[model samples]
Target: MLTAVMQCVFRILPAVWVLLACLGGASAQDYEAGFKAFQAGNYAQARGIWRPLADAGDAQAQYGLGVMYERGAGAIAADLGRAAHWYARAVGQGHPSAQNNLGLMFAQGRGVQRAPVRATKLWQSAAEAGHLMAQYNLGLAYYRGEGLERDNKTALRWFRRAARSGLPDGQYAMGQMYRLGVVVAQDNAKALAWYRRAAAQGHGKAESLAQALADDGWEAAKLDVPATGDAKVEASPVVPKQQAVGRASPDGSVRSAERSSPAGSGTTGSGQGVRADAARIWLGSLRTRAKARQHWRDMLRRFPEALRGASPSYSEVDLGDNGTFYRVLAVGYPHPEAAGRACQTLRAREPSAFCKVMAGGN
Candidate 1:
């Protein structure tokens, strides 16, 4: 009787494991379906799918519900109070975007009592967890001495981090900093380079600045002016120009640039030192070079530390009649476990950001 009972227990264990695995896959599929619905502008369907999952303690679904409530997307009415409630739940589960959004609400005193100090702390936490907007917001706080001591140097460091990650606002702010000689020495050339980068992303102010500098013949010989209809203009390295600087803008108004969303695609880094046979995380594929570049920039902004040593590379794949697609990849992960961990962190903030392990060269 003892041997028979032990055999039955062992037989049921494998079945239980299979059931659990199937449940996990089903959950992932449901989440993905909801995300696709959201992206397709079917917010009602997304909310319908996510509501149950969120109530059941799914962090990503909670974050999605928070966003829908905050934005009043689709059939939902805009409700900051409900947004805050869902955001609180998501952040408690370590959702990075939820933390950032809740921090913004606290900073602005929307649906919650005004608490700049608390807001700053939340932003700092999200920034450290690889939320790009939080990093930019924390940089702004440091620059303006909001809920923190004035520290222009520290502000510049954070701004540079965002700028290097290809954030247009950060690039523009860095240009303003260089132009005004705040913390760093005033350098017209460097300012122009940063502005050009920002302008490429459709920043209005940066476009005006770049055009003005070009028209004035200031460092004209050092710059490359793209002719009309050019497919691409390679930007030369930006070398800073030393000159006397002013302390403030002509209008004397506090210089603040609005935050811009990351582009759909962008590319960064060359797969130089990565071993050819190592595993890597495949991020996404885009139809255009511009979009590929935007995606790359977005990934860098969102995963700066995790991808510190990794390289961003792309390979073109031909799809007859549909044109070519650029496959974006983060190369240099030593194993699938490391890639999986980084993917989890990225997906916390960007639900649509896909990650899968692949051999380095493939």
Candidate 2:
């Protein structure tokens, strides 16, 4: 009888273990289904599915139920009290998302007293756990000194982290910081680089900035007057009035001019230097255009799916000639080369009409 009893107990042990496993799996499935429903905007379904599991100690379910209660879903009236209770439960369980959500409640006094310091701690906790959006929001909090001390360096560091994590807002924010030289050395090249990176990821403002930079560069290149190849290199583009400084036209033709020698005439190449400076500036602008093209190409290659067949759009183009005037040109190509060829064709028709590919253009 003892042997038989032992055998039965051994046989039932596996069954008991299987039952426990099934229950655990069912609980997980329930939480996931509820979470999905909530994400899909089905609040009633979310509440109905999550309430039981939440009561049974599923942290995710608890958080979902808390949100539902706070929002008043599934015939459940809005109850900040209940929301706070469930949120506290999840938060106590070390759920980062729950902590972040609860922190917002405290920060805004929705279900608790307003406590900025406490809220900042919770947000930082979540942010430190690699919650990307939370990292971005924490970065903003630090940037604006809301619920925390204003620290531009800390803000920039967080923003960069989020940007590297592929958050568009973070990328755009980092680009703006670089552009404005806030808490870092001002670098137009770096600013443009960040903008290009963000714009490639479909950040509208970044795209506009990158396009503007490219347009400015292209116009500057067009205005540059290349000197004569045979002219002596005077260490710079400056040429003395007596020697004559050659200028190039948009038509690729060169012209030379002469002016009276300076009053002192002691090798005063200031006039020549001014012309050379203009030429250098123009060349520098063209290089900017090249950089812009490279930026666009890099962005396109990174997200081919985003740019595929997308309409090419251009905003205000500041060529820096007279005013910020945009040279509007219609492009009918999806690929960059096609648009470039089209621009060349337009140049053939109108020498001043230069084309630069804009993001989201077909």
Candidate 3:
């Protein structure tokens, strides 16, 4: 009889443990129950289920209550004041969603005073915590110069982060930037790639853009040129003129007559001891195509012998929010090895030449 009783008690223990979890949860049964009730349109049931936990300082419950008040779900009249109250409670506990929602409220002055600065601060806090919407909002803020200095670079960084996280809106924004060459150089192939990604997720604008690019018969191309046979080096080094300093572009890049000179840039380490294999060399990455072309002309004048047979050409690249730039390369080498030798020789000959081999193209 004693052995049988002990067996029954052991079996009963699991049931008792389950019952205990439903009340508060080592199983989190109540919170889940509230969510199900809310989804089922039983707003009252959800609110009732959440209130106790909310009063006991559960952040998720507080956020749920805030939503309920804001949306007026389940017979609860929409109350922005109450919503703000609950959101403030959740935000006090550092809830990211609550922070983002409250930021919206602050931005629109719904239940709070309109404050762009406040909204931005809240968005930044939530954004840094990896909240996708917050990241997107922050990107817009920077893009539009709202509550902060307009910084295309910062905006691009945030937009890239949000897009990489699979936000459809962010993906669409990236596609637009690519298509329009807002910051990066316009590349239809890349624009189509981004648009297609968004379209796969049912982004309407992206769908149309992707279709348009497809209609245009755009095809992806290799971004880099392959290495070729040894290049002939024939250009003689010449004296660089002081008057050949190129005009400053908006992004602060300047091309010198000697080429590859950025304003306030110091000489990179001399790789004289190391083998260099530069088939091509970089002159400067300038803001605009015209600026790059001007720099190339300056280079030709500055290094007549060094660029004897070289023609002016530039490669375009989009740096997202940092903006689009064109890299003007000075080339005529038999091969990269020759180019590398020339760059090394130039650097050795004139420390101010700032000669650097193109590591590779983008």
Candidate 3 at 247: error in angstroms?
42
* lDDT per residue as tens, model 2, 88-202: 8987877665666666666556668977688778778877876554566577667657677788789889888766655545666766676567787866656565665545433
C-alpha RMSD of candidate 2: 28.0
Q: Among all windows of ten consecutive residues in candidate 3, which has the lowest summed lDDT? A: 11-20
The C-alpha stretches of model 1 lying farther than 4 A from their native spots are: 1-24, 220-362
Over 4 Å off, model 3: 1-27, 220-362
Q: Which candidate do you rate higher for lDDT, 1 or 2?
A: 1
At residue 208, what lDDT does model 1 achieve? 84
Q: Per-candidate TM vs. native?
A: 0.57, 0.50, 0.53
- Model 2 TM-score, 2 decimals: 0.50
Clashing pairs in 1: 265-291, 265-293, 265-294, 265-295, 266-292, 266-293, 266-294, 266-295, 266-296, 267-293
- Clash pairs for candidate 2: 311-360, 311-361, 312-360, 312-361, 312-362, 333-362
Model 3 residue 323 lDDT score: 42
Listed per model in order, the count of residue pairs whose N, CA or C atoms clash below 3 Å is: 10, 6, 12
Sorting all predicted structures by TM-score, with the top scorer first, yields 1, 3, 2
lDDT of 1 by residue, 198-236 (tens): 555445677688678766664412223221012222111
